[model samples]
Target chain A: MTDTQNSRDAVVIERTFDAPVVLIWRMWTEPEFLKEWYGPDGASIPIANMDVRVGGIRRVCMEMPSPNGPMQMWFTGEYREVVEHQRLVYTESVSAESGPVLSPTSPGTAGGHPMMTEVRVELEAVGNRTKMVMTHAGVPSDSPGAAGWAMALDKLAANIATNRGR
Target chain B: MTTAIDEDRLTETFAALANSTRRAILARLAEGGATVNELAEPFTLTLPAISKHIKVLERAGLVVRGQRAQYRPCVLDATPLEAVSTWADRYRPVWEARFDRMDDYLRQLRRQEGASEADD
Candidate 1:
């Protein structure tokens, strides 16, 4: 059931790098390389423990500045499949520093469990370059989960009747 | 970056929006401010139950009740909705930046390789 939900709410991103497939794969699998560019600008990965093999666990912490203070978010995932430079798949869960997964009720808050999602990275060699297609599956857009709020809001936006009652 | 207060509000807003009856009431109110009875007309729920839903929406800042009139019609306030949309879109720029950084790193790697080959 969750698998179907994830496929339905997946968000995909594709990028082509002017580098070989081997180098691109390293950027994803190696903690040293991943820490350099895993998150957005101004966000730092303070802790990155990546065991790239299948069934290995990958734990990372992304810290960024917030209005209140410095905010840290922990993500833990297990690699479901690893196909060298060709493909990689994993399941991700957002958790707290102590390691228990958070709930989705309080998004962006410390210790709030955002929905778990699967990520698939497919790398194809294109001459000297590499084409990477990243599919973040099961984003919970409308499932009985965190994304349900966003979906309901969308429905409300669409169903709003502009006709004012006099 | 999102603050804890903002996150709390978002959570409240989502919780308020989770119910189908409340969503229907909000849709009705979006058309125009309606009294509790008017909002309850479409659903099989009792007037008090609809009022309870309105209270939740009001707490979440999604709905506002007029004070000047006796009926106090519930009005839809879309400010929280806008916040929800912004939160949803927050990940896009992050991923874009990550990709751009990766591109830059790849260029640097190629440069080093080219320099090393020339030295050899």
Candidate 2:
């Protein structure tokens, strides 16, 4: 069935940091700082290529240890918006290295557009604290891809909180 | 009961939602409760097939089907979807952070590469 259904579902996470907006922005926009925190607890992102301009592409390969086994997924998409130190928006579709995306909803998307999800992140400076809010949309309400994305996000969060490098 | 949930429940709930058909069914029910016949009307599948699908959804506790006047009306049980949202909420920052860092690294690499080429 051709699922043309569109739902504006979003996931928002707000974090108030004890640091300045510039430092927080650096953690987000700098690769060196990113490597310190960007994945689940056990998983690591060894490959990342990005261009933060409008219409530019951001690509990364993620590897994680799963109970079923170790797995990898390539997240590739284009930048929709980039504001120097305030906000960024991008859309991503997951695909495999040498194969089509496993998600059925997103096809021809970088690899296998099995599932397509849009992400928006906003950083608000409140005094010396920085409040960051992130929204993830376009996840099909019932697609397994959403679930996978959810799992990946969980690991991604732990990866960030425990990041000792930055 | 607002008890802490397990990973298995989360996984089951997400797996149940992986199908577009199931999502459609959920969306339909979200508009309001609907009977098996009403739900199946939109699809070309057989009544028993839709029933089976409902069973999967029911097992996931995403919907609470009630029998009313010869109709099995399904109500949306957003609990599981909430779980899914919670799971996604945990990692949104990590990915955003990664993307941000990646962008900077690539720009830096590109700049260095350009400068080297200029020197050559």
Candidate 3:
């Protein structure tokens, strides 16, 4: 029995990079650069395809090495708003299609259980540094995929700021 | 064991830490392990009440309990707490971006007002 209903949970990640606001925004929109730094340490992005336009769907899958075995997660989202180099908003769902399904509580729990998520990415300039904030709202409190997504984002930011510390 | 540390686990952990009393209990455990009596000594509630709070903490993996004779000792588990720090550190840029956006909006308003003043 599914005890979880849809709930809104917000996570704000603010990082100041030595690069300009535009450069930082590029790292997010460009599929090639994003492929270099999107998932966790061991997770790799074999599929980084994006339409980069409004109402366009971007589907990316991550290959994660698990102790039990190797696993793959399909992160499919639609680009709701794509403002030049300032702000980007997208709604991400676990299913391969456009509708909802059973929510996956964790990373490996996706096939039978699926959860929907929405992420907003904003970029602004702070003095010589650029600050980017991505807020993820409407994640199930009991879903495992939510936690995996948080980790993946953290690793992604670190990979971007590996050299330039601000 | 829900060994998988994911968003759901984090929410449950944070919700458990949302309580001030439970946070204090964690602070106490950090110093060293303690039993129900020792854990409840600093609290205003009874031992049974503290036990309930400890149970919540244990479920979140913030604290671990061991059976020793008649007393169950609680140990501080810092692994799950690090998850919050790791996740928050990712968005240091996002906050700066928001602040800059606000600053630009204010600056533009000032510039527009000055232009009107010059026209007058």
Rank by lDDT, descending? 1, 2, 3
Once fitted onto the true fold, the runs of candidate 1 whose alpha carbons sit more than 4 angstroms away are A1-13, A39-43, A50-58, A63-128, A133-152, A158-166, B68-70, B116-120
Per-residue lDDT for B20-94 in model 2, tens only? 677678767766788999999999999999999899999989889887777868887776665655545554555
Q: Over the stretch A57-119, how does candidate 2's per-residue lDDT look in tens digits?
A: 777777777686767767767678999779888776555444454332332232212445567
Best by TM-score: 1
TM-score of 2: 0.48
Deviating ranges (above 4 Å) for candidate 2: A1-9, A65-70, A96-112, A140-166, B1-120
Error of 2 at B67 (Å): 19
Q: How does candidate 3 score on lDDT?
A: 0.61
Decreasing DockQ order of the candidates = 1, 2, 3
* 1 versus 3: better lDDT goes to: 1
Question: What is the CAPRI rating of model 3's predicted complex?
Answer: incorrect
lDDT of 2 at A23: 68
Candidate 3's displacement at residue A59, Å, is: 6.7
Q: Mark the regions of model 3 whose C-alpha exceeds 4 Å error after superposition.
A: A1-60, A63-71, A76-85, A89-120, A124-166, B1-12, B44-46, B82-120
